[model samples]
Target: MTRPHDAAILELKNLLGPKGWSMERDVLETHNREARGKFEGHADIILFPASTDEVAKAVAICAAHAIAIVPQGGNTGRCGGAVAGQDQVLLNLKRMNRITEIDARDFTATVEAGAILKTIQDAAEEHDLLFPLSLGAEGSCQIGGNLATNAGGLNVIRYGNARDLVLGLEVVLPDGSIWNGLSKLRKDNSGYDLRDLFIGAEGTLGIITKATLKLFPHPKHIATAWVAVPSPEAALDLLALARRTTGDAIAAFELMCGFAHDMSVTHLPNLTRPLASQTDWHVLIELTSSRPTDDLQSLLTDLLGDAMEGELARDATLAQSDAQRKNLWAIREGIPEAQGFEGGSIKHDVSVPVSKVPDLLTRGMAAARDLIPGIRPCPFGHVGDGNIHFNFTQPLDMDKADYLAHWENLNRVIHDIVAGLGGSISAEHGIGQLKRDELAHYASAEKLKLLRAVKAAIDPDNRLNPGKVV
Candidate 1:
């Protein structure tokens, strides 16, 4: 039987040509599945546009028929934001990969949405500049997806989120009109700040086509160290002391629970403990200086010494060489990937105030243990910025599906604690289909009204990323 949207699909295919559009089962299946494999949905068709003009034209066709469009970048998103539901069209931006310009003097790079994050970082390095948004999926995640989600990564402590790093964006609005707001100027102070609207909107407001990103002076000296802290409280204290002593030169401050560290060593090969003695919590610190004359190594060493003397850190290990530095970071980055091997992990990307981290972790762990005996809690992430990946691994010898059945129940138990502490349910990850209902439960009526107003004003037809965010 022919579907109702088949006619429109045929028209779209012809408009985009064979190379740009496809209804093949493999293509549909590939685009439908999300990164975490937790959510999946089907699409009516997939459209790949190579330029801003092509994207605008394709969007016009979809808008004419009132067909829902799901804009996708590298599909590296943890949330189901990139997945399209039945009768919706999946708009892929990989073909639009282009680094149009790199202004070394201005310290900015203008690139298409499909450009890979690592590629952009490498380009900046060639010009002796740094694109400081470093994430685990940098090699494959596209810049557009990063901006769409307002990604916060390791360097957020130093450079802020993706929204802070982007100077301008060129977006295709819901009605097929192009909004060319791409400017490299440091300060605009213009109208409603449309660039910020589309960013972190997850394509609900519009499609991000290209961006002008901010760059920093390349760090000539870098020092990485792993320290064992007695508790999360001590870790926070050490963070403060490090900032005060180093003059805010710390690039990344990560906190990992002992359980998370153990998981990494157990599942990931070639990963070893950084410190001699294992403590309840571990912190990985990195300091970078753009000036070649600065001795970041000695500075980090002095900070660690003071932390140990003050009892903020139980033990510490400074990377003596580049190889050691990479090894230390690998352990930090590998924790999420290594978690899969532990089975049925219920994950929560949450954030609380910097001071309340200890209370959150201590109380949260206690609650989970009480709820499910033998459940392994693996809470870890950017403690400096107050975000923590509060993940839980199922009890050993239990069925994976059976343990996953309690996902919703566990979410309630943990998210309630987060709410009580005035924290957010979703932190770095935006509200996609996965957290859509949760957002409704947590957001206030006024907040929901504002979101609805924005969605209505920009996409009254509800043809863009339907059933997401608002």
Candidate 2:
């Protein structure tokens, strides 16, 4: 006997035509996994809808047949949020890639969910504006995925996350209803903000089709610096000092553990080590402003001098040119991929209060080391937002599978400490299939109940991105 979803798949293909549907093994293979390649699942069909109406129609058909649909973007997610399972229908948004509108005067850009992050950034730059939410994956990640996860990148220290960047959204509800909420208005307090509900819902409530993103004036004067610190505490102190001096001109403050920097230099090609001595901690700082007369370098230098005088930063180097700035940034941006090349790592994207970061790292690293004796803890990420990617590499000559086998045990140890510190188990990467169980374990009963109720209300059939988030 054929399942109802099988027939639904056929109906969808017929409705969408060849250009809108694909079942080729190669194409399906490409859609099976996320950027990390950790959680790959097979999909029987991949649907490509060119517009929100088509997406609504396909979703309605799938909902009617009780078929699970996974909304996918550029597939650059660290979590397995976008991968389609063998029993699911993959709804790819690449065909809908478009910049619907760019209103420089209004300080907003309306874009399709499938638009690449870099493309939108480029568009904003063309208009002498800035789209500040950026990460290493910006070249490949999509706006929908960013909104879905509420991504926190380097500039999050200043401009904030993807959620803050979005003013309004166009979403396809679970029942296939198109909600046209794409307003560029900065202040619209009509009622409950629906955009906030779906911004970080991880596609559990609905599929985001389009969005109106906030833009800022492009910075005319920019400065980049790499600073050496004795510890996370020192780095945190230096961060406070910089903020006090520059106000909000401080654009980014990224923390890099020496282990992580060393790994990048060891693994990545042409990546020279930045600091003269291997300090326990380092911070990549960036300052920017639209004012042509803004002396970001002088401000940065003054802040660094104060930090050094206060014994917060041991040494620092400011970038003299664009190439030098890029080189300094490459060390920070390449850490994750370099760790990947090293071996299979048990990764956690966790966040604690900025004040508790040092303690969190101290206790978490100690516990992890005791568990695996020689496990290498490479904790690095957006220190400005207090989010860290606490990842562990296998011990020297230890079997990779053996170390991975202890992932659950290690996670419990680390997460228990996080909970004690009033921190989140899954921060920016989000609770997709990768952290769904963790969500259940960490979220309060009231929060869990509310999330579940929202999911039930929007996607009663649980056909949209099933087994994702709450």
Candidate 3:
């Protein structure tokens, strides 16, 4: 039996006053769609819980009445995990923003779900510590959302993803039970490891309210450089060279194709070219060390000199200042926006083994162009970690809608190549409405069954973010 909408709205309004809830259409429109403007859904009511108890109470009320609840944070997710269907109640974590604790001795920081990524990073920086999981959306994206999607970004090559950085989680379960598992211990041998389950569940199982995250000692010496390479193979080779020279000090190694760099300069403002020679490939390498006395620049200089002699690097430019370093990064960071201006683009956040990146790009590019004549493949991303954001801008003189019409076709071509290389189709982006079918098609039957079983066990009613990442 369908519950009456009036009764539901009245009950929610009484339970959470004007400070805690909003049923206004204009205000709720922002929460209807996703960050990419891809999928949109309606939630007549949105609850802004300021604390865990409120979130739990709101969930309990909704759970008893069999109303779906969607957990949202910052609404900066690339995937549509935060969106909800009609009549559902949206639980926005933004009001819960708070930095509860920062234990420098324990190397842990506890923050509420609504705390923005940049705010946490700033707090950590104040204490000469670092929380390295960072990305383009750090300024607006929240930590809970990052954990839900298990986001991977620039520092992933050195610091790992959101899952790795989290030490413990405080979540409001589907049944409205507040699970206080916020442990700050560096090592815990307790059984079940339930904290890991909710890390990347996309809020289907539970809503993360607070998190205790691991922090690292701030790096003393930092080095940044941009290198020009002849091919993807050469970029990979240069990555190996830098790894051998600097070892674990290498923080990020992003590869950008010449076309990608050119697009950035032409489409985006203030994005001047970084290298002297325009090679087919460009590598943005950064090195960081905790040792204050370390000479990162000299080390990088020697490594690049060797790479040049060995033909691994065609040319390179080292950033002499912080501003220069940012300019070098701007070229790679502006790929998404730059590509947006070029025309309609089909994006694939896929990953293959570093050893197979060259083959993957070469084969994938050839296959895509063959499928859509004159198609331009702009494959670039975290080359050191083997995760490439392979996107295709439409042909120079093609219709935007015509290019967009081939999204599925382009995805098939690229994902097929990724699968053939033993790679993942969705690397950092969660399996939201965008890639639900693709995930279902590619994931093994056993894996799918196991995932579904877990979801059923945790959220049998499917009240939390229905029709998403199941």
Clashes of each: 0, 0, 0
Off by over 4 Å in 3: 1-4
Q: What are the per-residue Cα lDDT tens digits for candidate 1 across 1-470?
A: 12327667777777778889887999888889899998897885789988898888888878887788899998989889999887788999999888999998999999999999999999999999999998999999999999999999998999999999999999999888999998988988877898999989999999999999999999999999999999999999999999999999999999999988887888898877787787789999999999989999899999999998999998999999998988888888899888899888999999999889999999999999998888999999999999999999999978989999989989988988998899998888888988888889988899999999999999998988988887
Put down candidate 2 lDDT per residue, 1-470, tens digits, no spaces: 12436678788987888899988989888888677878996787889999999999999998888778899988888779988776788898988889988898999999999999999999999999999989988998889989999998888888988899999999999889999999988899899999999998888788999999999999999999999999999998888888888977889999989889888889888876666877888899999999998899999999999988999988889998998898889999999888977777999999999899999999999999888998989999988888998988988778888889998999999999999999999878888888889889988999999999988988888888888887
Q: For residues 1-470, could you state the per-residue lDDT of candidate 3 as single tens digits?
A: 24427766677777778898886878789888677887886877789988898899889888888889999988887768888887788899998889999889999999999999999999999999999988998999899999999999999999898899999999999989989999987788878899989998899999999999999999898899999988898888888878887876899999988899999888888877887676888899999998989999999999999999999988989999999988988888888888888888889999999999999999999999899899888988998889999999899889999988999988898899999999999889888778889999999999999999999999998888888986
Candidate with maximal lDDT: 1
Which 10 successive residues of model 2 have the least lDDT summed?
1-10
- Model 1: ten consecutive residues of lowest lDDT: 1-10
Model 1 spans with C-alpha error above 4 angstroms: 1-6
Q: Each candidate: what lDDT?
A: 0.90, 0.89, 0.89
Q: After superposition, how far is residue 165 of candidate 3 from its true place, in Å?
A: 0.2
